[model samples]
Target: MRRTFCGSMIALAAMASPLSAESYPDVVSTSHYVPVRDGTRLAMSVYRPAVNTKAIEKPLPVIFVFTPYRGRSKDADGKVTETAMSDNLGLRSLLRAGYVVAVADIRGKGASFGHRRGFQDRTEALDGRDLVEWLAKQPYSDGSVGMVGCSYLGGAAFQVATTAPPSLKAAFIGASDLDKYAFVRNGGITAQFNTRPDEKPEVDLATVPMDEDRDGSMLKAAVAEHAENTPMGPLWYGMPYRDSMSAFTGTKFWEEVGPYTYLDTVKRAGIATYFWGNWRDEPTSQVILSAANLGSRFLAGPGSHCVPPEGFDLPGEIVHFFDHYLKHQDPDYGKLPRATYWVEGLNGTGGYVTSSELPGVRSHPLPWFLSQAGFGAQTSGAQGASTFTVDYDLPPAEYFAFWPRPMTEHGLGFAGGALQHDLKLVGYPVAQLKVSSDNPNADVFVYLDRIRADGTSEVISFGRLKLSHHKLSLAPYETLGLPWHSGFEKDVERPAAGEEVSLSIAMTPVSLVVPAGDRLRFVVAGADPRQRNLTDIKLDPAPRITVVWGGQDGSRVDLPLAN
Candidate 1:
């Protein structure tokens, strides 16, 4: 059913010969604006091999990328504040590989013009199809086109792939969120990361400066909604529950976001895709969703949301993948399995495995019981139940500071005992807790941490659940250690003061190798201002809470192990 390989640049490089810049001619960069069907134009920056790079007599496959986040920007006075790819995506390497690399700003950002919609805008999808068709018709194009981008750019790539554009050949994406609901509000709880703009502080404006003939029309309107939708923008992420929830409740986010992972629609599209996921970055679960829906080749590595591979040639890997798919070349690259991942805690052990499935295992469900004595993950036996108070009315204190501190430091929290032995937690974790509350609903925050003999602790994963929305939902076709909530259709009821109900909380997927001696701790509380990012989001106000740990029969955490 699967194949496995250890992750290493040396292994990936063996699939194909990396392109050498010395063997190619100089590159020529071109900036232009092409009109879409609506008469609006998109700004594209293209890098092509000069005559010296041995441009074949025929057209070549094109790598098209469209992003809302500006890779290029200009100051207020038409000054060139940034060129492009300042983040070092290694675009030049692709140019040397004999592929045309084009980066564009979706309708609203960069040098393009139009009313930019928030996250996954469908109009951008249409714009992407138009761009792909336009590039295919170009004299330089060999009629095939592929798209690449990470994070926001990856979001753009998904937009294009879902359009089912015939000119689009393949997509190489990284760190993108396809499902708006699951991505923005996991299990009906909002994400804190959306509140602020990513740290692209190199330029203040979203639009890059371009020549009058090359850039599109009124660019200021592009940033208008962006400014209103970004950092401190209450409706999307920052203080989401405050005014934005009620204000934008009726808005259709799916329409603006178009088709993405976690939906059946994306599965129908025909596109060869190569994706990348970081164990510590983005939503690792989404990677599983895409691999499941699209049947993609996914590679796992270290890096935050924006980074590619370190020490290895990410661009070179991209070139080999493109050549195999777009050029129809038969190389060992196609022989590799669909997935590859790095092993955690294996210092120089060179632990990398390749398989047909994503990193999370589907076989084992290890439950660590919650007890009165401690957060008992020992698996030996459960103590009694634990009780904690929840005061939604407790005059909000400094919630920001609480996010960075360990759960033990949270004054209103409870922590379980450490692990009984050295454990390796390799996938997303789920907390199946039996809880009761005085109020009709409650907001439960669950956290996972690793503790060493030296007492230094590192938080590995976190999960959130809203009591009213705690009804069980199982996904038959998907798994990454936890089942997805059926949805928030019918709110569940609380246990009339004395009775308790089961709450299955799904934490973000994670990879960790705990030393045989290091222990894992579980933390639970009413609210965590920052589930994953820095923010001041509180619980939905509950007066008191109780966690039932009926010894072996009671509550426990089921952790997915690497083995």
Candidate 2:
């Protein structure tokens, strides 16, 4: 049976700095067509703060966002709203602080002309550069620009920042991936979320027409042109290898489309970059820590994807960041810590921790050895192995969850001793397992869960690896001191039947404080319904997985404990 669950991204203001509705200035918004060098007319919406019902004439720093999701959409009642604009958490806050906000539909998605050649097309980056230069020259703009976005819009910000536009001064990215390939095909397994076959746009959704195009004549034309646009799903599914060439573009699409491939360009530009990420958001938190040494500031929160923890003034942080870089105000700006991450289970729900050095800088590895008597801090001398039959019928723990799935029921579970004191896990956890499978290939999933003294338990973090993609390599970019598997075509090493091999799987990065008397549980599984759907990985005729323990080839997990 199939099931589905839904969750919403939520944020609560830590401090209220409400702009009285009566005293708030009016916002005057207008839409126009900005032509790129390729003559594609990108639809842009410009909003300027007003003084006493009159649009301001003075120049101000512009905050720009380019998104594939409709930039400006109109509802049936003729009510219009900016899509993905709430990523800032406080849009009016930026405007009230003397900043002009601009939102544009990336080519082909909304009321923008031209087909998207590929996912996050390189051409779009050039278009971003052109838009930045154009916005800088606008009468209301102060020749300085900053970009703010989450997810895809964040990708756009990174892509555009790589172009190094002179007018671009700073950027704030949230819940975005550093490696596009790693994100879409995470851990060398295809992600099911963005790779659904031949998806279509929602019927009720409508793009807001540009000024003077109330009849939507131009909007219709733009929609018509979008029919020729390429779908990203097939492209993502087709490219299993990082070096795989896209049949559509006849180029290594992953490299061309990835912002990390051109990370040096962004570093050279020296844009004041700030990233906000969530611990529960797989890969995004990993990316933030990977880029920590790039001279970028980041806030690693203890929330799910795009969700912020309570009592954290996320909007206030954004305002402060922009105020420091864009306005050159705030005397205590540069003194802020380079990295700030939320530690879960602290002070009840959580609290923030700041570090002058990058995350995991002062962390030391705490290795736990696995055995039949459950895991222990000391290594076992006995040779033992556990075997479990693969059950494809069983659903993943927390099946159909929009949040992180729980450990599988059929998984082999081993528990460590109850903690004598509160143990803080602050970074990536690496699982080194020696295993043999009856099948030529198997998918390995490792979950780290916490079992409370009262018997309540929760999954902390999990990781998966397609056995065929287990070969390690030197990473092109920083990997937060975790093991790096290239997932390149050349590195694939599939095990033969009954062959034993060692796999170093890097679990997703997380920050949590396991309280005293709570025991840590490590679960390993050969099958996960969600991951199987993503990769359609084939199982053996009668799959029986064996995990070797004790001695030199024993399975173990190295946890990053903060000093």
Candidate 3:
């Protein structure tokens, strides 16, 4: 059986109240076809607070959301409908706070008329700027606009913010990837998930017809144009290196589309941004910390992907953030620190700790050495090594589960003695391994686990690196002293067979607490069965990997531990 832990944030999350019909009233909604600069039309759905079936005419701040997912659509009966609650990007919370909300579709998706030259094309970002300025000019808008979304929609806002639209005063970004190059091809390995393109609807059900497309003629034309839209799946697999160019875009496609490439200009725009992410989500927290100089606020919850933690009102927090930045209202958001991150295995206000500076800076490094006897705080005098054979037929690990089964049990395992006291781990960790492989190139997977007093163990964090792309260097941006691996072609070098190479692999950032009796365990393997070997290399004869440790220059892991 697996154990589950949870922390409560009811008091903090209760700052914003739940929506009530009497307090918020009904919302009046309308559909429109907004035109971009290139004569392409984008679909927008507008919702405003109403009284007695009539929309309020008073100007109010607008909450803007732009996404590739169908923002608005017309049913078979020709009735316009907004996206459902889960996909609306906190529409209810924004509306409950008495603000106008507008959601728009990207150029080539969801009833918008245009063709996508590439994934997250620059053209779509320009369209976002045009739409923001247009929304500010609307009669119901107070000339103030803010963007909100998670995942793809959150990424859209980041791209548009790079354009620096004057009316885009602030934004609420959640679980977004600022660096596409790092996201899709992390550590020089292409993720199987990113290699797949977004699913499309059939011609008859492509998207909803805009308000002006009475006979569905315009909608038909838009669907026809989508046929020429470039598929990102091929481009993802085709561009193996960070600097690889795409013939379709005729540029470094990944860097061009990534918002991180335009950080300087984005800083000049001075958008009061609020980033939200979970430790188990995409490395949005890393992006938030990297941009600490942007004078932004962030919330790093302890959850998976876009899901919020238990008893934490996620929508309520969004409302509080917008109330201060968008409506100029005096909400407690201004009274808090710049960052609030959740510490696992804790409860109440203590779990959600705040700090003026970004996370990872205040912690000290604690080194744990690995040897044939297992893990220990002190290094061993005698030199020794552990070896494991690459299992081509190993079972693939489940990707989306909250707790992974013990796949590393079949691999090389090391364990430390039970902790005498509670151990608190904070920030990023670096695994320094002296490894040698029979094959010229091998993918290394490291798993961090905690062994309970009951003898059961659970995974805490994991990291992977392709040996060929293990070259380290100073990051182009701020990483707060973390190791950076540049996956450029020039930096690529394979280790000679059986040659010992020292690798400092950076694991995922984490905040964890292990009880007094819990022991720390490290598992090292050749490849993760779930992840595809994007290197296009083979291990036909089943290569053996040996991990060298002990003596003066032994293998160890440096963890950031809070004092």
Candidate 4:
């Protein structure tokens, strides 16, 4: 027999009035202590309709959510006045349309008791599946469950769905990462900017109790390493990974953790999954790539992080999705379409345009070849068959000497130099370069800029490669029609210390409509200031930088030809 804890009055008071309290089902708050396979205790709170006492009734469908945030209620002063309610008010909207909602803390976070490791997708899936199994046995539960959330929670939802737990039905994963290293690490380079220096105030991992001896040791080591290794190292990677994975501990948790890694799991399980993302997002391309490859239903809209229901009509759409899957009312849900994207720069408001496929929006790859005329004003057309020498033994001054002052002031220079060109770009862009270097091995940095008429320039897109990992992956090509990975760790074949190599670099996607009369400039150099001290570690002895051509044929820039 398992011990179960019911919600206190505080929990009930926290969710007293859902937005649509007057109509539909009445919400009754309840709580429970769900036990993981390892005997670790997890906390869960429920929000469902108050049952009609007069008649015997069947069980109700439940939506189980797992989060690291506390599930306690709040007071008037915003203090912990009561047990937190489920943070997914978006999913609560579904409950108002009549479904039970269950919110739980993973193994070590919130009110749960256990060790918290980082990025443990496997444990989370087991917890999710076990919780569903437990719910099915409950008199009030109809034995059918679905999952929903953004970020880490979204990953957990997908993980649980992949298990094909009999009670698990569908999932809506928002702002998720399918490939751990690619999405967050970016070719072994951590996404330094997205993380805040301070720990999340919502949950305190330091005080969270550990369940096993190994858990305690791992947690202690991770903390010490993070504090010792400041500017760079394995510590940086371990900190974030531990913080995210510590909640769940299992193999399924790790394997199905990334957005890309879990795709096959979901497809094989025949789970109905929907992925959500926003345009202008740092990992926009990654999300698009995942959707295109997985054949999962995707929604890309305008916004930075998660698109709120009010701004992007997400609430209404989510309700429909849940209705179609949970209720089985819409047989055409999965067959409706492959992709639905929101195109920027339409209707004068930069609104959304739906598409059936990722390529429906037509990405024009334009190239702005480098020339010797200096920065943005160089319009010498194609200087085909020209060559430049790159010496890697020099210092930074020779390569980044003229980095514009505006960049330093705005912190853009840290990433790459900005070219003073004025041009409003309306599509994707790529660069092709023919190069010769004094050193056989060298890293190439390319920065794309939009130069204004007033001589001011802003860095728009950038990318990097070691020249050696140029060979594309055939796995994604064979299965999904896309490249899965860029083997950055592989060393480039030596160039005989003074040999030339023709190279083509792919940049991140940019959808800005550069203003007319503005010039588009390409800056190829040996170093990036922002990523300084990060990966692309400062070349100990600097390197020489030079430009060779500027034309459609010769080092060209590809741009999407818009309608």
TM-score of each: 0.82, 0.91, 0.89, 0.70
Q: Which residue ranges in model 2 land beyond 4 Å of their true spot? A: 1-24, 75-79, 84-87, 196-199, 202-205, 347-349, 394-402, 532-535, 540-542
lDDT of 2 by residue, 1-563 (tens): 11111112223243223321222245667788999998999998887766654667888888888988787777768786664235344555566556788889888878888888887778888899999999999999999999987777877888899899999999988777777777777667774445544435432138877885768788888877887878777777778899999987788988888777877888788888888777777756445653664668878777776676455777767767777787777667778788888888886677888888666667788998899888767776687999887766655433324244556476888888888888888877889998888875677778898889998888787777877887889988877667778878989988997788888987877688888899988888876666526335546464778889888769999888986
Tell me which of candidates 2 and 3 scores higher on TM-score: 2
The 0-to-1 C-alpha lDDT of every candidate, in the order given, reads 0.62, 0.75, 0.74, 0.52
Task: Report the lDDT tens digits of candidate 1 across residue range 1-563.
Answer: 11111112111221223533222334555666789989977777766655543344457778887876664665667765322223234455555566777788777566576655555556678899999999999998999999887777777888778877888888888877656556666666664545443433234244644445434334454444344333223445522221122234345543346244324544554578877877666465676666666777877775556566554557667777787788776467667788877666755333566786676654366776666555555563644666777533333334222123356555233455555555666677888887777765566777777777788986677777777667766553454435566443444444465557778877777665666656677777775545444234443444477777755567778887767
Candidate 4 vs. true structure, TM-score? 0.70
Candidate 4, residues 1-563, lDDT tens digits: the string is 11122323212211222222222333555555668778866767766644231111446667777775555433345564222233233554555556667777766555566645444346667887888777777787776677787666776776677667887777877766656545544433443432334333233334222233234453333233333212222323443321233222323222345545555666776667778776545555555555666666777765555545224556556666767776666567666666655554444345555556563245544344455444333354656443223323323232211122123231112121243432334334555666655544456666666666587776566655444433445443222232333433342254555455556555655545555555565656554443423334444454433334555544555554454
Better of 1 and 4 by lDDT: 1
Error of 2 at 87 (Å): 6.7
The candidate maximizing TM-score is: 2
| Candidate 3, 1-563: lDDT as tens digits | 11111112111223333432223445677777898898898888787866655677889889888978787555667674455223225566566567788888888787888888887768888999999999999999999999987777877888899999999988888777766876677777665545544566563255666666778788778777888888776777778777898877788888888777788888888788888887766465455653564567877888776676545667776777777777766555577788888887654223877898666768888988898778868666588998889766656545433334455656788899989987788787789888889886777878778898999987777777777877897666766776778777888889999988878877777787777888998888876655554234447777799999898888888887885
Question: Considering summed lDDT, which 10 consecutive residues are worst modelled in model 3?
Answer: 1-10
Judged by lDDT relative to the true structure, which candidate is superior, 1 or 2?
2
Off by more than 4 A, model 4: 1-26, 50-58, 73-89, 193-202, 205-259, 332-338, 359-361, 373-428, 434-460, 477-485, 488-505, 511-536, 543-554
Weakest ten-residue segment in model 4 by summed lDDT: 408-417
Model 1: worst 10 consecutive residues (lDDT sum): 1-10
lDDT of 2 at 36: 95
Model 1 alpha-carbon miss at residue 113, Å? 0.9
